[model samples]
Target: MNLKATIFGLLVFFISGQFALAQSTEIEKEITELSKKKWQWMADKNADSLAVLFHDKAKFVHMGGTWGKDREVDIIRSGGIHYKNADVHEVMVEVLNENTVILWNRITLLAVVGSNEVTNPFMVTEVYVKEDGNWKLADLTFSKLMTRD
Candidate 1:
């Protein structure tokens, strides 16, 4: 009787652990897809698409602190940070929960200003949350690695 009970308990525990792992993996994959969609929107310079990805009260810290959506729009419109070319690499995502995610990645930026080509490397951290059945970026932070010196 003792042996049978122990075997059944162990089997139940193993199955429960596997179920939890599968759920976590699914959440991770969903968050990763959301991050990819955001990057693609940026690359395409689709302001509307990018806007939808961000929560209305989203905060973006360019290289400093807290830039609002209006400021972001102005920067985009005035060509303050135009991307002639760019690439994202080495992206890693950490899931906080089913609705929250944190991601870090390295991005290379290339911009053209009337024949002058500028290339820069940046490290970025982004946070996203599932709100009202859609994923939206809650915060974005960046460090200008190549421009430090």
Candidate 2:
């Protein structure tokens, strides 16, 4: 190709690439919002909505060393992990090439389980994957802060 033609082609390619990246960022943000809403739904014991946000291969690791997808679903069903009051202070998103994203955040959870009241701050991480144009949680992990007496 001629020099001028080559330059124009390169410019167009660069612009389109940038546009695609911007669009991907926006889409990732939307997915993050959806994931947070799903957590809220879980806290509210809205099993139907929460189920929709989890992929078929979703796995969860509790801070207490519990691991099991079926048990996680059961916990949600029985309100075992209900969050009466919680706050997500910060969310950091790492995009893994358009279809996979990793989310990390710090959260403060204050709630009652049965008759016992628990309040703790924790760091949470979750992996989300896009399937058929929707993002769903594929893996989840949480760790609680420990304090010395």
Output the number of the TM-score-best candidate. Answer: 2
Give the per-residue lDDT of model 1 (tens digit) for 1-149: 69999999999999998987888788778877777776666655667777777787888886435787766655554556665555777688887877888888787867653356777788878898888888888888877885421
Error of 2 at 132 (Å): 2.2
Q: All models: lDDT? A: 0.74, 0.77
For model 1, what is the error of residue 34's alpha carbon versus the real structure, in angstroms, after optimal superposition?
2.2
TM-scores of all predicted structures = 0.78, 0.86
